[model samples]
Target: MKLAKHIKSALAIAAIGAASSAQALVVDGVTWNPNALNDFSATDAMYESIVSNIGDVVSGYSLVTQLNGTASAVFCPGCELTMTFTGYQLANVTLMADLVTPDQYFFTGGTINIYVDSTPDADFTDPTTYGDGILFLSLAAHTMGNGYTLISSPTPQVGNTGNGTGYLDVVGGSAASNFNTNKYGFAYTGNTAADFLFTSQFQLITNDDGDPVCLSSVNDSPICMQGANTINGNSIPEPMPLALVALGLFGLGLQRRLRRD
Candidate 1:
C-alpha cells in the first residue's frame, strides 16, 4: 500500500506538470536578446525568411512598408510597400526591427499586416484584440531622411502613431506605415500571460557608425537583409516545454523506485 501510494503521488505530480507545460507552444531559434543592442542590429540578427517551397513548416518572414516617411510625418499615397510573409503560422509570431543613428533618418512609422491561419479571437483569447494578436504604433521626436533612426526607447501604440489594430481582410489593405525601418511585430500580452510567449525586447544604439541599420534605399519598401533564425514550438525543449521533461523524469524515477522496493 505504501509503494502504491508513492507511485500514485508521483503520477499525480507528473500530470500536473504536463498540464502546466501546455500553457504555451515552444519555438526554437537563435535566442534574440534585446539587451544585445549591437548584436541585435547586426545583419545576422534578423529572422531568416523561411521559404515555403521547401518542406519547411513555418512560412516566409517578410516585411511590408506601408508608407515612406516624408520630410514631415505625413504618409504620401501610393508610397506604401507591402511584403508578404509566406508560410506564416497562426501561433505566436514575433517580428522585430531596429534603426541606428539619426542623420538622414526621418520619422519611420507604418502598419504591420498580419494574416494568421486562425481568426483573432480563435488564435489569441483576449477581451481586447489590441495586443492579443494585433498592435498599433507611433513614435515622437522621430527624425526622417536620416541614415539611421536609433531606438532609444520602446514606444507603444498611439493614435497619431498610426491607425488602429483592426482585422486584416483577405482582400483589403491589411497594414499601414508611418516610419520605414523602425516598426516591428509581436503578440498581444494584454489578454493572458500565456499570450506573452512571443515577446521581444528592444536594444538601443550600440555601435556608432557601425550600428546595424535596416534600410530601404527606395524610401518605401521592405528592406532586404539576411539573418539567421531558429523557431521551435513549446513541443520542443525550452522553458515553455520544461514541464513535459519534469513529468517524464518523475514518472521514470517512480517506476525505478517501485521496482527496487
Candidate 2:
C-alpha cells in the first residue's frame, strides 16, 4: 500500500467525498466513500499467535482475504482491527468480531472478572479502562442485520506512552501505546452513524516508511495491530443490495476464512 500510501489513501477518501452523507463515515448503513474502494484489489493474509481478549496475552495473527471482482463497496460493518506495537508508538486497536458471545461481561478494575466474548484479553481485564463498551464487539450486530459498525476510544497518553489499552511487555510499547483507538492516520470517515469498517487495510509502516507517531492524529490511535502483511489494490462498485450481500459474503470465503494457517 504505497503509491505514496495510495496518495495517503487517496487523500483520505477524498475527505469522504467532501462530507455530508450525514457527516460521512459508515459501512453497514453504507455511506463510506473512498468511492467505496473503487479499484479495490487484494492479496492480504497474515497469522501469528499468543491469544487473549482481555486475558492479556494479546498477540495472535490472522489476515485472510476476500471481496470479489466488480469493484466493491460495503459499510458500517463491524469488527476487524487488532493492532498494538512498539518503536513507532502505535498502541491499541481491537474492534474484534471472532463471535463467541453468550453474554456475560463485567469488569470492576483490578479483581472483578466475567468475560464471554468481544476482544477481551488482558489476563486481568483492563482494555484501557474499558470505556467504549460494546465491550469491543463480537458481532453485536451488522452481520448483515443492517446495523453495527464500530470505532472505539479511550487510550490517551502518547509521548512516554502510559495510557491504558496496550500493556503487553515489550517494555517499549507493545500493547501499552494505548488500545482500541484510531484518531486519524488512515484518516477515518464513517458517518451515517458509522457502525464499523476495516475490511482489511491492516496498517503500520514506519521505519522510515513514514506515517506513524500514532498515525499523526485526527485524534489518535495505536496499541496492538496485526497484518499478514500482504497487499495489492484496485476496486469494485456496488452501491447497494446490501452492498451486494455484504461483499458477496466477503467473496464466498463466507464472512472471511480464505486462509489462516
Candidate 3:
C-alpha cells in the first residue's frame, strides 16, 4: 500500500509539472506573438491562401490575431477585434439582376483597418506605419467581404461555408464602364462577449473587363450572403491553469488518504 501511494503521488507531481510547462504564451488578448509571426503555421497559411485563392470561391476564410496593447497607450483595454463584409453578393439575391451584364468581378487592392470602436482613429489605419497592433494582408480588388458573424443559435454549423447573413447594395454604371470603381463596404463590430473567430466564404465573379469593381452604396437589402469556410475553432483561450493544478492536488490528496488507510 505504501509503494502504491508513493507511485500515485509521483504521478500527480509529474502532472502538475507538465501542466505548468504547457501553459500558452499570451500577451494582451492575442495568443500568437506578432514578433514571432513565422512560428504560427496556421496564420501564415491563412495569409498565403487568401492571396493565392483570390479568384476562387472562398468557402471558408477567417484570420484571427492578437492586438498589441503595449504598442499604443491609447489602446482600449479588453477591446475585441472586428471585421465587416459589404458588397453586392451580401445584398439581396434579387439585386444580382441589377449588376452589369457580365455579372463578374475581381479583387483589386484595399486596406482593412482594425479598430477598438466602429470609427477608426487616423493612427490605426495603416499597419506599416503604425508598427504595432495591426495586421496587413494583400487582398485582390473584386473580393467581397471577409470575416465572421455570431449567430443566436446554440450550435453553429462548424464547417458550413454559407452559414452567416449578409446584405446587398447597387453597383451602378453603364454597360461600357461597368461601374468598375464603385465598391461595397463591410464593417466589423468589436464585441468581446465571446472568443474571437474570423470567418468568410467567397465566390469569384469573373467578368470581361478582368478588372476589379469597387462597391458603391445605393440601398440596403436583407440578409443575402451565408456560409463560412475557414473558422478559427481553436481561438478560445484554454481554461485557467488553476484548474489543472487543482486536479493535481486532488490526486495527491487521494494518495495521502490511501496511505493513511
- Candidate 1: how large is its RMSD? 19.0
Q: In candidate 3, how many Å is residue 156 off?
A: 26
| lDDT scores in order | 0.26, 0.26, 0.30
TM-scores of all candidate predictions against the true structure: 0.21, 0.18, 0.26
Can you write out model 1's per-residue Cα lDDT over 1-261, one digit (the tens) per residue? 676677677777776776565433211111222222221221112222211121222211322221111211122122221122222212221234444421111112222233221121221111122122222211121112221111111222221111111111112221112112222222222221110011122222122564444332211222223322211111122243465567667767878777798
**Model 3, span 1-261: residue lDDT tens:** 676666677667767666554444343333433233222212111111112222222212122233332222222334333322222122112123654532222332222222222222322122222212333222122333433222111111223222222222212211112112222232332222211233334322223664322121112222212223222212222334665567667767877777688
Model 2 scores worst on lDDT over the 10 consecutive residues at 106-115
Clash totals in order: 41, 59, 35
TM-score, structure 2 vs. true = 0.18
lDDT of 2: 0.26
lDDT string for model 2 (1-261, tens) is 233444445444544443433233332222223343432222223321221234222222231233322212232123222222112121234444654422211111111111112332322112332222232122111111111122222222222211121111111112112212222222223222112223322333233544333212111222333233221222122233344344344444431342332
**TM-score leaderboard ranking:** 3, 1, 2
